[model samples]
Target chain A: MKRDLALLLGILLALLAALLLWALHATLALEPGPRLAELASARLEQTGVSNPVTAVLLNYRAYDTLLELAVLLAALLGIWSLGPAPAGYQRSGPALAALVDWIVPLAILAGGYMLWVGGHAPGGAFQAGALLGAAGVILRLSGEPSAGLPGEPAQRWLVVLGAGVFALVGGGLLASGFGFLTYPPGQAKWLILLIESAATVAIGVTLTAAYVGGRPGSGTAHNGTGQSRTVQR
Target chain B: MADLLILPVLVPLLGGLLATALPVRSALVGTLAALATSLSGLSITLLVWLHGDLGTVLGGWGVPLGIGLSADGLSAALLAMASLVALAISIYAGSYFAGSAQARHFWPLWLLLWSALNGVFLAADLFNLYVMLELLGLSAAALGALTGKREAIAANLRYLLVGLLGSLTYLLGVALLYTAYGTLDIGLLGERLGPTPIAATALALMVSGLALKTALFPLHFWLPPAHANAPAPVSAALSALVVKASFYLILRLWTELFAPITDIGAATLLGLLGAGAVLWGSWRALRAQRLKLLAAYSTVAQIGYLFLFFPLLASLPPGTARDDLFAACVLMALTHGFAKAGFFLAAGLVQQKAGHDRISELGGVAQRMPATTFSIALAGSALVGLPPSGSFIGKWVLMRGAFETGQWWWLPVTVLGTLLAAAYVFRVLSRAFGLEPTPLQFVTNARTEIPALLLAFASVALLGLAAGPVWAVLGFGAAPA
Candidate 1:
């Protein structure tokens, strides 16, 4: 019965894919009228960022990005609520530790570079944050507990930093009679950089905490049963 | 005035962040934030009431390039209902999870979910709605699993996965629409959309996705366990607000955005599924062993009733009759929002007192906690479409619509669902009247009991006795003419 069900589902999925492709083809075949691309490029300079993607993310559609950060924080909080982190792996060998010693610093430096170049280039907060998070993961694999993250209290503040700063800036703007998230004239670049910097730190911390897979603590307060369920990755 | 539109979403968001950072003071911050958020939402509703409609593009960027927030009559009516229900839930939660580790986690996630709910009601961009939906889904699922029990965890995990799939499907439809029309703004898309095959396909995909999330029959398998196994406060939010958010989306899409392409045949198909849900869900609720489970199944039936209006709406010509039908649909939704939240809150108190919510075992709870029992009775009456309940008016309109539209086949479904609803509600009430030592006062633990009682009273008295406001808020002229 299970096999039959699976086969039926597979067939249905195939049909759906075919239908979706056809629909996409029909949709794209229409006159690709004036889209946001033209409008975004036309008003690019006013956004204070050369990169249109950054302009959209940080300036025009910043509300969505702010909520996306909240989504990230919510996910990490969900993980933490399950319980504290399990025991870390065994200590790494001298060679592995040495490799981490070199790679971690280089990753951090690259992350900073990415954050800086994000104004006019491909790298940005999310990418830079991912690099920093990778470094944390490497540190964890080398047997560092907590993924080298701070204590619980500081970790809490770090996870919310991105969304908090973004909201604060927006609210400040609104209070000053500018629309929410509306950067002041001649100040959009600096504001975007500030928001992006905070976001990078927040994203990095959130990703690392996620990799740790649970709350960062000694596990004394939480229920004892959670330990058995915690997978040691 | 339009600039104030963002506060409903902003206040709760900042509150969530604050609550996360200051875990020790989360409850206080969360409660204050809930108050502020409700005020902002209610004020927005009031503004829309006084001033027709309000719209604002964020960051001063114009539409088709920037996201817009708009509050129309439809959104404002729902927003008013959501604000009141959410504030009551927040109060109930302050007591429900008091002095537990869960309280710290619950407040932050709960506030985040509130922000998303507000975002959904006001968002003018389809993609922004998608983002809001994701945030709502994630926080709701997480909040549902706060109990840490195996069943709760398993059920919520399934819910999370299902919600993600639904959002992805919806996003695909959004992408399709954006690709075709080159805009994500709902207003712009509505103006540009035609009766094209791609438009139909996009509608199908989007409605299907939303239906899955809304737990529209046949696709409602994941809702029962997920809702029933959740902590009570979470269960109330899930049943009352979360499901309604998705249904609200479907209603907007069906009646406004997709109206140009939507045919009566498709609307009838939805009504048929709704009929199935009404019967199936009510039958299941009638047989449910536990109170929360019964409430969950009843939510399924209630949602079914909401969809039953689609066909009637499609068949009606554009005029006061159609407008009245639309207002009735919104009234039914608002009534359910209050009734279900009240039912779940009261049930939560009963469960806490008794250590279990098995319907057969709840005998003396009514006598001991008269206020809570009364809440349940009142909320259950609204569910059963009793006299003077908002749903009573809702059903009256529904049956009348059925007759006028010649969709008389739906009459039997409505009557049978109402009968089953009464049977289930009375089954619990019967348990409540059993011999036991009665308390002297009506309310015990005013913090918890009052919110439930007020919500139940709102559904029965406030909404039913004075439904003119609902019509007025919907801009259908006072008293439905």
Candidate 2:
């Protein structure tokens, strides 16, 4: 009965989607102009960055980006709450370990480059952070426990660095009567860079910690018992 | 003053980050943050009460380009309710998670969730609302799963997935709106919106997505387990505040942004779903074996009552009648926010004292904890719309609206739902009155007990008796004659 109900609901959902698509097709035929894009480009000079995307992301709607960082932090904190990380794999053979050693440093260098080029080009903190995160994952697969993350105390600070710095900057701006996240004239570029740099480190650390899949270190021994209780249930 | 609107969202966010960094001092940081957030929120409400409305574009960019934050009568009223209820929950949590391993995890995530709730209330940009919703969903699900129970984990995992889907669907609708209108600001879109098919489709999509998150009837399957299994304070926030945030958005969209596109048919469909929810949820609460589960189911029923206003609101002409009905709707939501939080907190205490919350076995513990029992009873009265409770006023107005519009069918549903609510509330209260030795003291565990008692009192006395201020906050001047 449940399976049949699911199938019926699926069909109904498909019909709804089709109807929505038809409506959208008729609406788009009216040809809404690229007004927002033009506006962003027109105002790009006022923003610190040359990239229109960054202009909107960091200056125009910076509040959204700040909250997005908080969302990332929330996700990482959620992962940490589950329990301690599972044991790492046995030490990798020398050849794979050597490969990981070479790849990790190179990935870090590339990540730095990506972060630098984001001001004028396509790469930004997120892409750079992903590379850094990949480097940490490689280290973990090579049998480094903690996934190349520092101890729990340092890990906490690193994870919050992005959102913490972003919020502090915004708050400081607000206090200075510039409004929240509103950069001062001629300082928008440097401010965006500083915020992006902090976000990159935080995102990279958060992603690596999330890859570890649980809380780090010896402080969370209580959750071990809680995990066993779940098993018993 | 307009710039102060961002403080409510910012203060808690900074606190969450600080709490995340300083695990040992997390509780202290969380408490301070909660206090600051509530004060900032209430101040915004005060400012709105003094001034008509306030709006600001972040980064000094004009609307349609930059994100904006705004506070009007509707947002201010909900903001004030959320502030008080959250402050109470934070106090209750300070005791509930005291010295536990979950304290560090709970503080940061709870603060983050509070920040998102504020963000949702103040946001004037559609995409910004989506971001706030995602943050709210993520933190809420994480907090709900804090118990580490198998059922809690499973239920919250489902909740997280469902939330993501809802946000994505809502985002799709937003993308369509941007495509059609070239703006994401609520005020700008409202000005530009016409009765176009795209606008209609976007409204449908957005409302449907928000309905899932709000747990409107058929989409509420995940809510009961997720809410029932969470640690009590988390459950209180989930049931009381988080669901209402999404419903607030739907109300804003329907009456403010999508008014030209909205019609009686869609509103009636929503009302019918609400009727289904009222019956199904209240019936389930009556059948629930556990105290927490009963409270969770009651939330589903309470949300149904809020939606019942939509059909009436759609049909009512712009006059004092419509204005009064809207105030009553906001009153019902605020009362439920306080009442449900109180109910869940008291239920948690009962569960703690008894080591289980099984309703059938609660009589002894319920008798032992007099303060807790009283809290439950007060909250239950509000839930059942008893005399001199805020929901009584809400129901009176709801029924009046129904009669005024000649939609008399809703009156029967309203009546039946109320009867069911009374039955379930009395059933629980009856457990408290069982023949066990009465506690010598009326108050115990002042830290926790007082918060629950105060919340319930607010629902019954503050809201029920002095609801005139609710209209004043909503800019409706005085209470309806």
Candidate 3:
């Protein structure tokens, strides 16, 4: 009876929300120009990217993207702090292991291509990074030790590399009196490409590390004091 | 000049990243970074207070086209409060987590959370605010679960989900506003907003979302467990600063964007809910068995007091009385920020010493730590609105405004909540006065005990006696009387 009551109430709330949304839709007046896109286009030359989205992500509103990377790193840090990685899955059979060996290198190549393409085309750091993360997932599924990633210390450095690089570039610009992330017109392209490349590698590592679901080995293997308590209810 | 405005957000981001990347496990680097971040933030606050509001358009793009950071009186007040409270918590945490494995995890996340708090206070663009809010929420949730206990993880999982829900709801509101207004800057949206169904619905979505994040009344269920179960410094930050960020946003949106569309009826409804929160939260706090849980519930009651000012502010005409009400609201919120951080830090010490926080078993344990006990006493007195504390002045102005507006009903609720606050505070204090050996020194473990004592002292002495500067800093011309 309680479940039925809750269901009924939930449906009623949904209907009410739909009604309100319909009323809102009827009254909203969308402006003629796509304002952000137009702004991006007007400043595209100075931003040094042929693609408007890349210009926006890397140049125009780079602060948001910087903080977004911090969010991803924070999630990975949270996972690692919980405990060391669970022991690797039972080693994959011969067929699966053989397949993984071929797939991993191709994924890395594809990630690099995507990273390079993001400067003038439809791809960007996040897309490239997702590809690399997929490779790590593939390796993990094949029961590879360390998930084809670095040790814990190297993993920590790699995870923080994207945000670290972004901040350095921004601060360097600020120090040079052009303000944060404000690349000069001629240098904008190279600077953005550099940041994006760094970002691609860092995001790829972070996402894969997050997927591994715990701290990397070798760092915590010897320090018993560092081990997080097993969660006991 | 723009560098000054941006540095508060930038320093912490850099510091956090460096702290995470560096192999140095000592807490010195993180503590110094936190110190620099707080000092930079304080300089910004001082500049804004002295020179009036300052705004900077990033990347040399003007408003409506690029993101900007702004510091008005509201931002300045909250920024100052966050800086002071965060610095104290940082110091407390440095000592509390010393030699623990979690120290490495604690510092970076804490700095990131500070960066997000400053970002939320200073962000001028709506979407930028959303990004900052997400960073704040994610870091806060992660920090909350750092204890790695089952209940901590469970509670903070719920917190994370609730935070995500709030952000999505707020983003939908921003979308609707952008759909109508052609811009996402708060100033431009304010100029374009009108009394329409879309605007009203957007208001509801955004406020409801913030209400959830702020833990207002009926939506406050997730706060207690999430707050009380975290490590002490994390709990201090969660209650004292994280929730206040959302409340600050709600206040900003209400005054800046929704002012033209708002009605008295809506204000009264919010005030009514505030009354409910005060009564319900305080009652629960009184009945709470654990020290941290009581502190958590007290936070709920304190938030209710903040909401109570809205209806009174809405009803009165634009003049000194209303301005006094507004200033009082800000003052009270700041006082609670300092007092609550002190309370939680001290409670953590008590819990650490006793191995548990069961209120019934805290008799000899609390009395042993004289310095921490004194810190709790001062914080509790401030919480209960005793004379010479900031809340006393704030409640005086608030109640006067209620009477002047002929909304006399809120007064009784305020009085009851105050009484309940006193009861719970005394319940803990009563334990301290029980038969036990007296300590030889008042300042024990100066590193941890001093932060709590200093914060509690500031809430009562600095805020109470020197509140005139707060009025002046907020750019109000003179006292309302």
Q: What lDDT tens digits, residue by residue, belong to model 2 across residues A112-221? A: 99998998999888999999999988888888876788888899999999998899999999999999898999999999999999999998988988897878765445
**Candidate 3 lDDT over residue span A1-233, tens digit each:** 99999999999999968967785666553434235667668877888889888887888788888889988987887887787776566678899888888999999999999999998988999999999999998887777646789886788888888888888898898889988777776998888888888899898999888887887766447357465423211
Candidate 3 per-residue lDDT, tens place, B57-129, comes to 7766677766788898889999999999999999999999998889888888888899999999999989999
Q: TM-score winner among the candidates?
A: 1
Between which residue pairs do clashes occur in model 1?
none
Better of 2 and 3 by DockQ: 2
Candidates in descending DockQ order: 1, 2, 3
Model 2 Cα RMSD, 1 decimal: 2.5
Query: On residues B133-188, what C-alpha lDDT tens digit does candidate 2 reach at each position?
Result: 99999999999999999999999999999999999989989988988899999999
**TM-scores, all models, native as reference:** 0.98, 0.97, 0.97
Which should have the higher lDDT, number 1 or number 3? 1
Q: How much is the lDDT of residue B328 in candidate 1?
A: 90
Error of 3 at B466 (Å): 0.9
Measured with DockQ on alpha carbons, how good is candidate 1?
0.83
Off by over 4 Å in 1: A218-233, B437-443
Lowest summed lDDT window (length 10), candidate 1 chain B:
B434-443
Compare candidates 2 and 3 on lDDT and give the better one: 2
The deviation in Å at residue B394 for candidate 3 is: 1.0
Identify the CAPRI category of the predicted complex in candidate 3: medium
